[model samples]
Target: MQELEKKEFERLLPYLYKRKERCPTFVFAVLERFIPGFVFADDLNSPKTIFVGTDSGLYFVGGPISNVAFNKHFLKFCSSKLKEGRRFTLFSGSGGWDGLISDCFRLELKQSSRYSFTFHPEEYGVKEVQLQEPFTVSRLDEATIRSSHEFNLEYYERFWGSAGHFLDKGFGYSVIDGETALAGECTSIFRGKVYAEIDIYVDAEYRGMGVAKKAAQAFIDHCLKNEMIPCWDCNVENLASRKLADRLGFREPSSYSIFVKNQ
Candidate 1:
């Protein structure tokens, strides 16, 4: 497999579009150069398979499932990267791809299901959330993010590379109680071309207080105003996340598999 440069990244778009399901936003983040990642294909000129790796995870698209040489090369590449201490989780959209990866990896791998949801603005309507005194909803600015001792700050840096980049390319909201951020919802993966996948966190002490819902509503409002499609993804077993997405009018749950190192 050959690593394709950023300019060559677009060549894989046709393959991505061929998939029936929505492509993961992280894949677009890499292709758009919004974040650092690598793209590889079986052939530069006439590719049969494509692979994308990012700090978040790995994705595979395109095929000739029987390409033994490319499969071996892919396995060797993954082994080397894993040995180098990179925690790469393989995301598979179809059972065929899941089976392919399972057969190739000799190491113990754990499997999990992730659910993807699409937002329906009509269903959500224009409801407003009112917070009591001492609690407020605020846009996620650099200052607020920097001052936050919660997950929001680390999320931007880890996923978007830095707060500056996140500010320029993405947006979010947080619910604060007094001087502390109680909950936050932000763009976990965004590609201006289409969707913005949300990521949310609520302080343990503040769970079930509607703080997370408030933050998420504000985030969704921004996405609607900007004409960007809002998307939600979570582990299938995360009932809280699934319920929140449903409450937010995100419908059509689709299941996909992700393989991670057994730990």
Candidate 2:
């Protein structure tokens, strides 16, 4: 497999478009150069199979699944990357690709189901949240972003490369107790032409409270005000995330399989 340069990334867009369901937003993030990643294909000029890998995850799109040589090369590449300590969770909408991956890395891969949710405005109406003393909800600013890192805030760095990038092209909301951010909801992946994928995190000390929902509501409202479609995704096993999504107006969940390193 040949690695494609950034300029050649667009060549894979047609393959992405042909798929019936939405590919993960991180796929688009790599193509759009919003973040660092790699793309590989059987042939750059006219390719039938493509792979996109970012810090977030790995994806395979389009193919003649029976291409033994290509499949072998992919396995070797993945093996080498794993040895280098790079973590990857493979995602695809094609059963054929899933089967091929499952067969090749039977011992090393663990299978999991991921659920995607679509936002329904009619189901969600804004509600004011009352925070007890010393807590407040606010938009993420530079100072907030910097301070949040103390709480292990990673969405901005992981998806946007840096705080400057996120502040310029992305947005988020955080629930802070005094100067410490206890919870937040931000765009994990965003494409101006498409949608923003929501990522939420709450500190262990504040899990049961409604802090996450409060932050997510503000984030959702911002997306609506800007006419951006907000998207949600979570592992099928994460019942809490599912419940939160439903309460925030996300519905019609579609399930997909993902393969992650067993470790």
Candidate 3:
């Protein structure tokens, strides 16, 4: 497979936009901020298939444009990447990639259900609420990163690599109880300049309170102010998150299937 240059990468916009909800959001953001290092079959001028990788152990396939089948060359390329020791979760529209590898190689595919939710600013009516005792909402920044609870530190480290990266590449708000972070809502995956996937976490002790709700509202407000749209995706089994998305004015999530390689 030939690597696609930036100009060539832009040509996939129509295909990507056509399957917006099906594609991962980070693809959009990474293409905007970083070089995709994307590879495609044929020349960049017109590609029949596209492939890109993610830091989160995912290999994304965009298409087999114009009814073309993914050939042996591309499958070998995928095998080479998989041999690098990263377990891959493949995201492709429909069932095209279902057994493309297993049929030729020893690996297997395990499919799972996923959902995507989009926010509508017009449907969201911000509610003014009183700041009760010990509950405070504040924008997460360098100062807060240093002073926030261990949970927040672990969270930033896990998803963002470092608090510094989060500060530079992400934005969010935290609900604090005095000095402790009770809950937070931040961009887990940023997609282009216009969309971000929301990630929220609340301490187990504080679950029944409206901590997440308040923090998410503040986070959504920040997105709206900057003209960014917020997206929420969760496993179908996570009922609590599904309810939260509904309460936050996110439309019903669109369900999609993802193939995760069995480890």
Candidate 4:
């Protein structure tokens, strides 16, 4: 198992989930590989694997992209992290979800619009209103996507491989227009586990017509189709984002802040 230190791994976040509009790339961006981003069972030939923490839920990567397996200390760590209100922990083959890991988690929240825990499928009484019309989303190839910005070369280099890496693990994206993109709310996960940490953007010119919401619902539907839970998490202070989540039926499980151990 290879661990990606938080500091070095976070720097590669931006390009991973790029958009011309608002998106949820915060937690998954840099923290994707924070503590135990990648790990494998003792069976070296079992499968190459990785795990990522998202604002909403945990993600897996492996055997080409990444996969989310179990880890030994997962339940113990989940217990510790949860002593507080909100937190995330990844589990590799070290633990089991049903016997032990399940003890540390609830049913990962059902898709509801009860903003206190979720923001989808249901609401006070009615469902959420649409935010925008959906458009096809896609990943900009590294060479092509690289030409779009000039923040860091190393970042783009990692991106060239990440789409394939993440895609193989069930992550996907679509083109908002032709150039811009509306990325994953996660499409597949083998089980009826609808999970998606949707943080996407609508181009400035495309705002006010429900571009973001439209694309997000589309992504959410993708999760539903696969039976994966689609979820969203945002800073309580991010009123706009919070409202958007509520509008889309993503309820807040709780709110908390992350402190940089060194910062």
Candidate 5:
């Protein structure tokens, strides 16, 4: 067993690039952004086969974590000891990724289960589409943070929750009326200097209002000002999500499939 540090994960930079041109893996991008890649490493026993991410938490994608493997001190060092809240995955592996990470918590699995959307800045252009009266979008700030109301914890926990963290990191904008979040988006993360991601969410009552698409473009513009790229991705079967991504000029960058276990 081997150990890795948060800042030392950049050694896995090559894998980040390999996955970037395709779908952007959320965890890979998050760790890469939050820490250096030298700290990230492939499990030597697993080789070019499996990989793991270490930080305030430990996430695995390459191999099955047998009791011995998960308990090893080396593994202990990278994986999170606090098993309370939850962690998330952006975009990731193929048909077999779930089998490879059976030891990961159900929460982590829930976070990674969604298909990723990758949107490009050059492909995104916004017209001055006005919103319905009594609604407006403002920059996210301390006040805005307090003003925003999230409707669902589970959806936010997995998808929107990750976006919220990223929003707190960089520039984010929200659409609201009287403190209600009709829809919102943030400049989540960068895949190299060339690409960025727009994480958007719309309230159930506010669907079809273009709140998601417009707010998403605002975040994309913000990414451009910061010298990054952005994209949106969604599952093919998700008609609404796919339509929203398409409205914002995002297309499927690669193939993706979803998995779930009926425990």
Candidate 6:
């Protein structure tokens, strides 16, 4: 795929019809602030379809790209990128690339609903549980971030990359067990105004202990205090996550699909 230069990127914005999501938008925000080598690309003619790829995944943005020729180019470009081993997942709103990619690759096309829930602390009622012994839930700051990096570099790298950036732009809460970070609830993606999407990471050993819920509560409280609304999203089949959202007073789950690339 041909990369779009700054001017080309800006000029193409008005013509693009991207899906409304905070995560990918957060990538764009990070690109603007850090210039972290993020790439944006699209077809040459009409340029109806486009995407932005980061370390985490590929985000398909813009258009009713029904053109056959463009789809083929898009496929070739993505396959090449996949071989390069940077982006691991494909997230699209409308381009029908899921089907196109499946037709060419052996990857499994798993279907799941994307759930978006709203936050209302008052509705949480008595379900809120404070962290007790063996667990300390607190706002994740620079110090904790460093400790986490030192604790487990390989596993925490996903959550640790650009930690400072996210901490500055939004907020995060971590469940610490003495020295180890057991679980965390952080603002994964945000639009810098009224919305921030929540992403949680709980160590396998700490699952089902209400650690995620506690950390999430801390994050939700921060958002409410700051006049920002917190959003929780996940695959519908993720029952535990759905339950956690329910516990945090999030209502009205929604659905969407993201294509995960298999190795």
Model 5 misplacement above 4 A = 19-25, 33-40, 43-50, 53-92, 96-114, 120-122, 151-168, 178-196, 257-263
What is the C-alpha local distance difference test score of each model? Answer: 0.76, 0.76, 0.67, 0.40, 0.51, 0.60
lDDT comparison, 1 vs 3, better candidate: 1
Steric clash pairs (candidate 6)? 114-255, 114-256
Q: Residue-wise lDDT of candidate 5 within 1-263, one digit each (tens)? A: 45455555555555555643343444455445642232333453333433444332334443334535533542344244323444423223554454443444344444334455565545567475588767787776555555446523333334333445535444567787655544654534333344555556666777777777667767777767887656565555677777666666666545553333223
Candidate 2 TM-score, C-alpha based: 0.83
Per-residue C-alpha lDDT of model 2 across residues 135-230, encoded as one tens digit per residue: 888777877776664423475666567778877777788888886745654544555435678888887788888888888888888888889778
- Candidates' TM-scores? 0.88, 0.83, 0.81, 0.43, 0.64, 0.70
Residue 198 displacement in candidate 5 (angstroms):
2.9
Segments in model 3 whose C-alpha atoms lie over 4 Å from true places? 6-8, 18-22, 34-43, 65-71, 99-107, 126-131, 146-162
Q: 1-263, model 6: which lDDT tens digit per residue?
A: 45666555554443442435333444443334332335444554445556665554545543455766556666776677778756556665543654555567655434334766767767866466766676777776667667663333332334335555556665677888876655554544443355566777777777777777777777788878788777777887889888888877898775556666664
lDDT of 1 by residue, 1-263 (tens): 78899899888777666667777888877887777788888888877677787765565444655777777777787777667665668777577778877776646667789999989999897467677778888777877777666645676777777788888887778787888655554544556456677878787777887887888888888888888788899999999999989999999999988888877
Backbone Cα, N, C clashes tallied per candidate: 0, 0, 2, 53, 28, 2
Model 6: per-residue Cα lDDT at residue 51: 61
Better of 2 and 5 by TM-score: 2
After aligning candidate 3 to the native by TM-score, how far in Å is the CA of 102 from where it should be?
A: 6.6
Q: Compared with the true structure, what per-residue lDDT tens digits does model 3 show for residues 113-195?
A: 77888787777885744557778888777776676554366666654566777777788787878776555544444546767
Model 1 segments more than 4 A misplaced: 43-48, 55-64, 179-181, 189-192
Q: Taking the tens digit of each residue's C-alpha lDDT, what string does model 4 give over 134-178?
A: 545443344333333321234322332233433444343333445
**Judged by lDDT relative to the true structure, which candidate is superior, 2 or 6?**
2
